[model samples]
Target: ASYSVRRVVKKSKRRYGRKLESQFQHGGSRSLWQGLRTITDYRTPSSRMVNADASLADELNARFKAADNHANGASGTNSVHAERAGEVNTFTTSEHDVRRAFKRVNTR
Candidate 1:
């Protein structure tokens, strides 16, 4: 039946997973790397690998900025207003004042 077939497939997958775990535990460094690559599906970069430098980063930033500008151009709702913070008058307190305040506390 289809139910029995599904159970058999699940059991086989579990057995394969256990086999991979055992390989990770008992295998050498090479096998460990192989197992990791297998699990992650890691692939070597092509010859046209991009060097990560400031110029490439700036280009990406500019592209993203242009895209954001284009997307938000139609909707003129991105204005942010800055508010001035209330000024506080400074008051000087001495160590004697701090000690006297601490002494009034009950030490229970």
Candidate 2:
């Protein structure tokens, strides 16, 4: 299994090193290195685990990308707090009129 991971990292580092190489590189702290090793093990590939890891990674990546797309959209950027901020602009109805109308309708 050791060689299984070495081979995968070696190959992937060549193409997409920026995203994953630092994960395998030596860390500043011993504990951090140990944590990376554990993750490396879970991500380590085998004939069996390779397909499963790829499937799960693809699904998770798709979800993140979809969320990213939405966040970058104009509609998604207006959060609930921001939407309610300028909503009090005086319109045809006043603050009290809308509530009174609702009460009149409900009373009937």
Candidate 3:
């Protein structure tokens, strides 16, 4: 009786030779450069630059708020989650606004 758990092993060794720009510089992490294209049909202004922090904060806050609402009186964890959710939401929007203002100042 040979019951063996088959496991995937990468026998071929190859170094990943690539130059990666961090989200702060290039405005995106996780090799998702392809997703940077604007959704609008019209071409984006040549001068427009993406602000990574604003984008990140907006995303993080929304998710936290949603999670806290779902916690719903389970225990102290729920209360903590709700409090943190509000904090995250506030921080996200505040940072986003500041980032937007900063970009406007720089671009003009």
Candidate 4:
């Protein structure tokens, strides 16, 4: 059941991502700005609206930073060290494993 739900979610995400990409390609900056505005205009759980005068980019950045700081504090790790560790880990990809995965996809 969980697998089926995951598959539906993945499909929806891919479809939406493609639609956004197409919109950005054809509509350019206007489409991107509209999407951001729509997302940020959503009402909070308390039914309060986001301040119209506030810069959405700054607001989002501050919120994300706070969330990141909280997560780091909970995990007992400094953000700088965590970020550096992530950068180091990205280089450890296995080409053989990746190729095998793609082969399985082709078989499907």
Please say which candidate is ahead in lDDT: 1 or 3. 1
> Compared with the true structure, what per-residue lDDT tens digits does model 1 show for residues 1-108?
999999999999898788777777886658867877887898878876466789887999877766765776734333321122344558999999999999999974
- Over the stretch 1-108, how does candidate 4's per-residue lDDT look in tens digits? 999999999999898778778888886778776776786685436745655555877899777877887876754545686668756454566999898888889542
**Least accurate 10 contiguous residues by lDDT in model 4:** 42-51
Of 3 and 4, the candidate ranking higher by lDDT: 4
Clashes of each: 0, 0, 0, 0
Clashing pairs in 4: none
- TM-scores vs. true structure, each candidate: 0.34, 0.21, 0.21, 0.33
**Model 3 stretches astray by more than 4 angstroms:** 1-51, 73-108
Ten-residue stretch with the least lDDT total in model 2: 19-28
Off by over 4 Å in 2: 1-52, 74-108
Q: Pick the candidate with the highest lDDT.
A: 4
The C-alpha lDDT values of all candidates are 0.74, 0.66, 0.51, 0.75
TM-score of 2: 0.21
